[model samples]
Target: MGQRIFRRVSLGIMMCVLATGLVFAGSPLPNPPHKGEGILTVNIQGVFNAKVSLSPFKGLKTVEPIATVADVRGNKSAKIKIPAQYFPGEFLLRLDYRAKEADAPYPAERIIYINQQNIEITVNPPYINNDEKTKFNSGEKENTVFSAFMKENNAKRMPLDLLRQFLLSYDQPKSKLYTEGVKEFEQRRVEYNTWLANQAKIHSKLYVSRLFQFQYIPAIIWSGDAKERVNQILKNYFEGINFSDPLIIRSRELSRFMDGYMGLYGMQATTVALRDSLFTQAGSVACEKASKGDPQVYGWMVDYFYTGYESYDIKPGITMLQKHINNPDCFTSKKQQITQRLESMARLVPGALAPDFTMNDNIGKSFKFYQWKPQARNKLILFWTTTCSDCLKLVGELSEWYKQPANKKKLDIVAINLDEPEVKIGKWKAVIANLSSWKHLHAEEGVNSPIAREYAILSMPVMFLIGSKNNVIVSTPGTIEQLVKDLK
Candidate 1:
């Protein structure tokens, strides 16, 4: 019985030890931890005591100033607590603190922005002497001058230097200095263009032509003497090149560039002529070369011509395009679209007679091209405008066409001007005064002209062929060859 009692006592002791181990394992030991979020300790070491109050911005629930204190300590320092939630986006942290009576100014105001992080701003008193103020102003002026010189030099080293200068100067705070800088920059562009022109002439190279192709042509067009000089130089250069010579290929390529450049200059008719001439030459060369089995050269020639034709006129462009389409290795999906656009436009071809339409003239007098002359042969009515670059570009082509036997014997050409002011009509007349083979009419009523609206004239320099019966034949703009073919 004594041994059994001893075993019971041993079991009881084991249970007590097991319970103590479980309790120790379940509960963690105590550790010395960090206090409230973080503390902002402000140390004021100045001759004057400061009054400090910190207030949190609105919409922030957790952040608030713990307290306000007066006489914060002329020799001692203080601390303030800042909550973590106040640190993001844009918030105004206002500090209204006052200095001692003898200090420069009491309650110096500071506005701080809490943006993605905390900011520490330390306040210090300004110098109390006049000599320091004078030195500060003088140094500021020197720094300003140095900064301006650096900006100007840096801008000059960049592309579009003049534009950069203008933008930089314009963005400066409004002042006489900024305004003068802007005027100077404006004048600099004129000087630069003048220098560019002289260099172009001296090099006997088509600098403006090259510039027009690569850079912005509209700016050159709007520019003064550069436009006229560039146009004259291009014309002269074009006259010098022999179109039939193989060596003249580079010069012929210039014509493609001129096609686009002329459009920008409002020489629509001339642009078209240049484009057509280049493509015709290129296409003929490619076709001839392909026949000789020079597929590589032929392909290159085909691509060059195709690009020129695409930008100029997509309809008549199809004549040369058919050869490319027939070649299995040369045609692409884009070329397929060209074929489709041509077919769609072909439905408006000549011999169908012109569509009947009433259009008001510039003077508000309504007229009809179909009714102009009932007994006239097939009439070639060109719908164009004084402002149209493509229309002006077409004049050279028209002049060439007028010399052709088929066109001379079978058709009469008429030009319709769609310029706004009545005075602009006279201007248009003067512009094309040299072309005596065509009649000119102006629609001063602008886009409101009934004729332009009826045909859905979204693009300018459109041409129409009207048959002898005054029926619309082709509404699509055609080249001289296409027009002659239709006439035949």
Candidate 2:
């Protein structure tokens, strides 16, 4: 379980890395950008025509490069002018380079901390973090202190983690070795946490110091079963965390902290019902803890659980979020989304009238959803996109199902295309050409279209079964089998 926490931290960082997209600009560096903007000079070696980019971590989302310098040949440097809004935090420096002149460009990325100071770094792209191959300015404060802190912190934490593992796994609980192990574990945990706290205070003014509390090891009860131990961990997980400090969200470790917090509840569940119940309880506990702090943090907690609950179709968990979303002080950006979801849950349930919507069919015919009466008992409205693989799969299944005479007599399919950017409209035309038996309509603005908002279509492959009587939603079937089952 301790190991799981560490792994989640790494997973969080990797997720950030994977979601990031680097933008390349052909224009030269800014003459003088935002006031007090720092200068970052990157000297590349052993690669020709390298592209260097700099990005900063914002919230718990994908990162985009604020500046990029392309065509940086070997032994030459690229000067990237940092933007003022992104400073005083950790940034990712990425280098896309070719070892040989004709070889394809391979990318390498390294995390670098920046404040208001002008800093210069030289690196071999393939060996970006190699102490001998990469060098930072000797006068650099944030990265220098951070690099040293990582080494020292790891050294102090290694033995403590080892002792924890021993205490959890050791069979001879009645023996002196077990007792000695527990004592050593307690001693090391205290020493590590004490050092962690002091370091956090000592470097409180530095941007990197925001990450220290992530390393603060919490107390554990090694004397219980796994479930009991998880409960104890849940109780002590937020021991030293300061949720009131909004700056903590700028670090990737906060997501990792969230993962560990959520993972505890996940580890305890043996069935789907138990999982939903525990997750609902988890949301209540975690959100309550965050609600007492910064409004942004509180909103972040709500957004996190809302995403989880919606993705898992956890109605109980989603309902448990009403108080958090309704709180006036919570400043979550997802407020509109949560409100829409809650509204959707109430209005789109079985037997409720499906909202009327207008859309243009494939041949530019205006189609009003409620006015049309199909020659079937039910009308299945599918909100999908041509590019979605799942949507394509469901289309195939539905087409096959529709071929059966009895099934076709019972249900009519109307697929609402949510393809975006205008380019996908060509693909939509090509796709619907084959499914001539079904009605196809495109929402010009995709997910943001008014019809989509009315239906609360958060993701693709959403379906609503409308009865022929008054367009009331008969069922919201997830699969063709479910649709068949519901009709039966």
Q: For residues 1-488, what per-residue lDDT tens digits would candidate 2 score against the true structure? A: 00112122222222122110111111222223237667999999987769899888754453888888978999999998877767666678899999989999999988888765789999999999886889988887778889899999878766766666667667888899998888888787777667777786777667677777777666657677756766776776665677776666665767767776776677667777897898899889989988998898899888778877765667788888888888987878788877788889998999788899877788889998888898998999998887777788888999988989898899888999999989888999998898898998988898899999989987668889989768988999877888999998
lDDT by residue (168-204, candidate 1, tens digit) is: 4344536776556545554664554444334324322
Clashes of each: 30, 0
Mind sharing the TM-score for model 1? Answer: 0.31
**Candidate 1 at residue 323, lDDT?**
69
The number of the candidate with the highest lDDT is: 2
Q: Pick the TM-score winner.
A: 2
The weakest ten consecutive residues by lDDT in model 2 span 17-26
Q: Which stretches of candidate 2 lie over 4 Å from their true place?
A: 1-35, 171-176, 326-328, 362-368, 371-376, 386-410, 425-438, 478-485
Each model's C-alpha lDDT? 0.44, 0.77
* Residue-level error in angstroms, candidate 2, position 410: 5.3
Report how far off residue 235 is in candidate 1 (Å).
39
